[model samples]
Target: MVPEANPRVGQLTTQWQRGKDKIAAALISLVLIVGVVAQAGFAWQVHLNGEEIGVVKDKASLVALIEARTHEVEADKGYEVGLASQVEFRKIVSFSSDDAEAVKETLSEGLEFGLKATAIIVNGTEVAALATLEEAEGLLEQLKSRFIKTSSNLEVEAVRFREDVELEETYCRVEDIVDKDAALNVLLHGSEKLLQHTVARGESLWTIAFKYQLGVSSLKAANPNIKPEVLPIGSKLSLKLDEPFVRVEVVEKQTYNKSIPFATTYTTDSSLWTWDSKVKVAGKAGAQQVTARIVSVNGKEEKRDILSTQITASPTTQVVARGTKTAPSLSTGTFLWPTTGVITSPYGMRWGAMHSGVDIGAPKGTAIKAADSGMVTFSGWNGGYGYMVKIDHGNGTSTLYAHSSKLLVSQSSVVEKGQVIALVGSTGNSYGAHLHFEVHLNGKQVNPLNYFR
Candidate 1:
């Protein structure tokens, strides 16, 4: 009645609706599949300047991957890549008075690189930095910027790199009831290497090499950068020797005692005085006995070979006296006036000020003589004393001859009493040819006339 329509048309419309639903479901499934495939294809890679280094799966592999990449880069660049294990570094820094604490705090924050830092300081001021050598240079720059306002200078003392490699190993079994020691020998001889020694204090490169039956040239060649003429104390030098040498525990203890003489000029009267013998070196334990005579000339010490060392427990101590106990003997004869001169200034207070020494007027180039038997301590232009010569007489007495035209005796040269020491002239703070002479007792200025008679 309601115009009962075509059943075939109705059925066709239902089929069309079902086909559309199927198509929609297929599109959704395809989208999900594409998303999963894309995710699977994703990867993390590192690159420098668009050049791929390597691929890493996740964050956990970052450190190892980076190290590998760096190694690869080093190889390509032909860089001599020092193993991180072998490197050591040190640093020294100075900070201003106000910013010392802040600078220290910044340094304590640790370096960006994975290296250990040990700081040594004096009064909250850092004096030394210890770390790996590779990290030293870069960290130094960073520290410089950080403490630019606080510190004016910084220094690095020693950079060290060392490594040990183990190459091969082998196992051996006893064969047929031979001596156990013989089997041990075979095992030892199969793969053996020499033991090396490091050059230590009081030890020469040649001596160390010779002790180990090694070649001196070989040792020198190994240490190419080290100058043979100027080997620093405690430098590590190489040693060569055949294998199977016994490790000798040679415990040697040496005590060295040295006497040093110090003299100071008296500020009051310009007199020179010598203090008691002071100990220059305290006794210490050493691996071997070292005995040498050191002569100090002009504040410089020259060491000469005295004796070769031997291994001993409680070795005989080396005693070096600064000078002989006997005072320098002199012919107690009246000394003639070094130059025909008139007294320009007396050694005393004048013009409401202290006149340090006696000034004698003479023509320039007058020869000056040593007042007593002693060593020439000073012969140079002093600030206000002009060209000065200080002589040390052994009995805590000394003399100063200043304002000289020429110096005759150099510092530390032994001279006889009345021997020519300098020439009189106007040199420092002088108006004309004159000799300024003063006497000192235990480093305090006294009247030159007290010792003149």
Candidate 2:
């Protein structure tokens, strides 16, 4: 009835319709897949006391949530908790979010019980921690009482444990709770064990303490029965650790008696002859009672205070008489020994030659003196005489000192009687240290012993 449609046009129309159908089917399939994927499961997140603990997908009941969280918390913290006790649950709905780790961590924190621990501290450092404040304080008191005596005369100024203490809220395990005796032992002696030291020869308590890095008082306190001054050889010494956790300090006042030695005094008498002395009175030691306050730490004295002293018996003072008489000088027709020695050679003729002086053996550097007050005429090296000093007495008398180590006076110097003028030596014509001394009377050599006494 119409013009026959072209075969190519018909084919093109068919292809266009098929492509449109394919695109429609693809859009429908994508919509269905998106709808299925959007559907998600939801659960209630349980929390204790306003804190989120865990989510519940199967059981939405609060009781079931509490039981589950309790068991989980107990297993996580290694401790059990009372069911629904001190616990409040809060539910927060969440979808497609797995918070198992956060829930466990929150439940662990919520189930923990805050514990307060008191610490025994020494020198601002914590030494031990106790369960309760009363226990810690009691331990400190017990340690202080170890050094306190029960005697009526025992006066305690202050008793204290040498450490800083504090109480704080912290987490602790059930096993860490300490008992009374255990706490006391740890508070006093610390965790370190007793170190044994064998006493060696020439080892004293002080040396032992120094070697072990302990106080001498602490060393003595460890062995109360042994004396510190007299230590037995090969004895065992219980040396503890240095700087003990607790130091028991005590102050006491005591009275003791001791002897006071008397002193000697001398009285000079000008009329008494020289080399004469007499004891007028004898001295005797007296007794004194002293009251002192002593402060000791760990049984060792740290400080001492002398309260008062009373003399029980009066001391007898010693009295001695000393002579003050003046000796005669050279101007009084006398001479003194120039030096101290035994005369080895006398002034005489020997070996067919006249020996004009006396030779006295003395040590080198011995002081040589002027026999009498005179003026020095010669002081220098002499032929075969070594260092010599000659003095003119200004009364037709002169003296000579030879063989000296050194000359101390210059020529023309006035010297007093018995004044040091030279030192002994063996300089020339000599084999040893000696002094050849001569006394000349009006140019004639004479025996020096006749002038010296």
Candidate 3:
């Protein structure tokens, strides 16, 4: 103002003021940018029931971590496990207070937040749930197999679950997810047990089952490969308590043929010896067709019914002839000794019993002669008198030679006096090799010494 405002001084002063204004604007812009950056800062925080669980930069990253933990649990427990899908966020807000690692550590402590899960409902009853429907179905299938029976001739009509299965959303601790296999085992068997049994000598299926308080049918069902009838010694058998969850019924139709045996008949033939026979017809068996219906449950046969029976062929009857021939010999009431031997026991009371005939001692295979024989009546095994030969002497008198080794003549054959009719033998109540001689007059046994010469 004093020097009329020097132009260079005014221009310099204006430049300084403009520079200060530029610096102030730059500082204000920088402060506003810093405030915006601080306000825009974001982090995802997981909370359960208004309680903070963990904080992560991204929600997806937290989910990935939970999945990794689930895989680890699956490997350790040998089952399928996953983070429950029913997890709900109480708050999803920006959280810059902690890093991702600190949040992960806090979640790993399992103190506040829990995993969302699905509940398995069976017929309105809760059972269990997995992370996925496929895994849950797999577990249920395993349970079904435990109750199923195999290797049966019956046809399985259908397999259905006894309960209505459904999946429901729920929440639980991250460690509460059940292992698929173990859960199935616990549901089916109630407890885990493994018992082995070995067969021993004289041990039968019934005995073994009784010893173990088990049923025979259950044993058969458990051991399909072993035969119930022929159980080998030292063979092992698996023992367990059976819990059936499904009813399995099997039906079968069978057809088979059975044989109808033939019958035999005999006719008397007077032309041959007593022991001889001839077959006039041969016997044959017949066939019958049978149809049956069988019903079984859980590999056990429950009922069987025969539908029909048809005779395919008739059986033929067999006819045979038995000989009844006899030899006759004429006599004059006078007789000769049948065999040459010493009389060891005479006809009288012997050993508290009446001796009906004389016992003439002789060697085996000795020749025996008839004493005026008439008709041969009996020849064969006789009670107390073995190999006897009875002859009618035509004059109301008959002669008998017992204990003979062989008979050379047949019945109904004519013979003369003094003929050799039989040989001596030790047969029929005989003490040694001997001949028993007797004579009868009109069916009455008498002394033969009066007629024999």
Q: List lDDT for all candidates, in order.
A: 0.53, 0.75, 0.70
Candidate 2 root-mean-square deviation in Å: 21.7
Query: Residue pairs in steric clash, candidate 2?
Result: 49-88
Candidates' TM-scores? 0.29, 0.34, 0.35
Lowest lDDT block of 10, candidate 2: 84-93
Candidate 1 deviant stretches above 4 angstroms: 1-336
Collision count for each candidate, in order: 7, 1, 13
- What's the residue-level lDDT of 255 in candidate 1? 34
Better of 2 and 3 by lDDT: 2
Q: Which pairs in model 1 have colliding backbones?
A: 86-162, 88-133, 89-131, 91-129, 96-150, 272-440, 273-443
Q: What ranges in model 2 sit over 4 Å off?
A: 1-88, 92-97, 105-113, 116-130, 140-251, 258-264, 269-284, 292-313, 331-453
lDDT of 3 by residue, 293-376 (tens): 766664567787888899999999888988775333366646677777788889888889988888888889888887775767
Task: Give the alpha carbon lDDT tens digit for every residue of 48-120 in model 2.
Answer: 7666556755333445555776676557644444443355443344455445556555555555332456766
Choose the strongest candidate by lDDT.
Answer: 2
